[model samples]
Target: MPKRIMFTMGDIACAEGAISAGCRYFGGYPITPATEIAEWMARRMPEVGGAYVQYEDEIASITSVIGASWTGTKAMTATSGPGVSLMMEAVGLAVMTETPLVLVNIMRGGPSTGQPTRGQQGDVMQAKWGSHGDYQIIALTPASVQEMFDETIRAFNLSERYRVPVFLLADETVGHMRERLVIPDEKDIKLEYRKLPTVDPSEYLPFKPDDDLVPPMALLGTKYQFYATGLTHDERGYPSDKEEVQIELITRLNNKILKNADKIVEVEEFMLDDAEIAVIAYGTPSRSAKRAIKDVRQEGIRAGLLRLKTVWPFPERHVVDLATKVKQIIVAEQNLGQIYYMVKAAASPTPVHLMTKPAGMPQLPQEIVQMIREVHSS
Candidate 1:
């Protein structure tokens, strides 16, 4: 296949990316900003020999994705804030089961149904803590329509490689924005599939992990008779009540991510070689910050931008390193300050300031430039 380039919106590009990544199953509910993802999947899945199901709600949507993944399908689901809220418990179930799946949260403003049409970064923290308990998650935040396409594919690959749920944390601003998207030839796009169990059915212990700490997933309808449940489980995937079982299970889940943070976390630094003030941002806000940094640079402010391409498993090392060299770090996002706290903690000893735009469009470039000047002067 040849490279295809076209203009498209972020949500639609994300759906196309999933299909390109070999996602054969999509189960999701329709919601503002993210509905295009499901709509695109519904129309395109049949053409590509895939399945698309619009569930009754987000809970059923996520539940169906988990079940489909167990069947050895590349399954995914997309929704906005309220829908994600409804799927929290099921999210926990996926984490506990170590299911490899993709979730696209096109974040809209919310504590409730705050603003369905508006975009916000309020869900940054929710993506990490919405589900109960201690488990690590892979989340990527895309700043533009092009990234929505590229990052969706990356999300699926990561989920499969790590045997964990991965999220594309987009927002209404990016999801609805139009831009040029380039689709590479299938042969050129890198893809990853979950490792399958090779042991005989009788010898199979479903959750038994390899040295990487990611277990070989057994297909649901296969000859394997391994059991799986939400309860704390051992290598055999059976529920366990013992303290050691809980510790072993939870610890491995955490270690799989913590141990590989360097490989999983990614960020983009712009014009920071000799920057005096560093601006850390992601998602829609990063777009504004980029333009703002350029504006400040023209004014001789020596500003730079640190854009997070992978939001969760927060890129602490990069932020900490930037903090040491820059005089001060300015954190910007669409939310009041969800990720700001993480940056402050990681970039401690060095001063960190925040520029927040709550439940609104991403802060404008002019506004951000003004903030840069304020931080630069003081």
Candidate 2:
């Protein structure tokens, strides 16, 4: 069989990927570096019998998605840093209700509306910690146009599989880049839908979980009179403020992702078998890290790369193991060390170093190479 490849922009690939993954509805307000995703969905969704609505604000945009998800439809939204800030409350709502949702944050520079057109990965921690209260989230970072398409599908699958909001945390660099992407046949795409209630709807408890800590979903118009709220809820989905109920609900939410971290998170290990130095990175910077790793190797440095495909759940075990094996680790990002402390904490005693560039553009391969040499010499 001949290999098939298509040339397209990353944002277009992402919107198409969502459609292919059965995303039937997308509700979002337009924002820079992310508006292309919304525009693509607007043009494409109707042809596929899906729905795309440009809401008045990011808050409503995300709220509408939560409502649509309850109808048993695969739904999503796209936004950047400021919009993500607007959606934080709804994000907490999704978590409290255990709603299966997907959000694409095409991150750009931001303290407050900073550099709308440029790329920056300042949201490295926000994607995981933005929502209030304690809960787990699945966030995938794509370093290339291909992974933007590929990981969007994976985001939907994992979102349904875990009944948590999954995120495709793409930076502006990858979101705007034009590249070749091999579109796989529909049959080749592995799709996982939300698990339905097996028993009669009368026997259903909306917040009740099966063995894996994931509750089966029943659509809104179904026979079940399903109820859910952002407030702390019981197994029956009615709001409960009891101390024990709070503990059980929150504990289960945290454990579902943490206990199953091995299954839910993925990281790439490149040329690290006998490497004395390791470079850890994700999102667009990982692209540069790959380049630096190759070039550093040419200069007789046994440097390896650990590219995070799944940024959340932290991949602590992988970092810890590599820490024990390597003499030093370099944490690189497009922001001023947002994820650097995470690496330092996880790679304790490995003397992790930080290389960060704030806004404007992604960290270049040459910049990373210089840092690698400095760390190697030190």
TM-score for each model: 0.99, 0.98
Task: Name the TM-score of candidate 2.
Answer: 0.98
Q: Give all candidates' CA lDDT scores.
A: 0.92, 0.91
lDDT of 2 by residue, 1-378 (tens): 134587988898899889888999999999999999999999999998999999999999999999999999999999999999999899889888888999999999988899999999899789989988988898999988899999999999999999999989998999999999888888788899999898887789988988899999888988888778888989999988899999999999988889889998899999999899999999888988999989999999999999989988888899999999999999888899977887888888789888888877778899999999999899
RMSD of each: 0.9, 1.4
Which residue pairs come into collision in candidate 2?
none
Q: Which portions of model 2 show Cα errors greater than 4 Å?
A: 1-4
The sequence of per-residue lDDT tens digits that candidate 1 reaches over residues 232-342 is 999989898999999999999999988988989989999999999999999888988999999988899998999999988999999999998899999998988988999
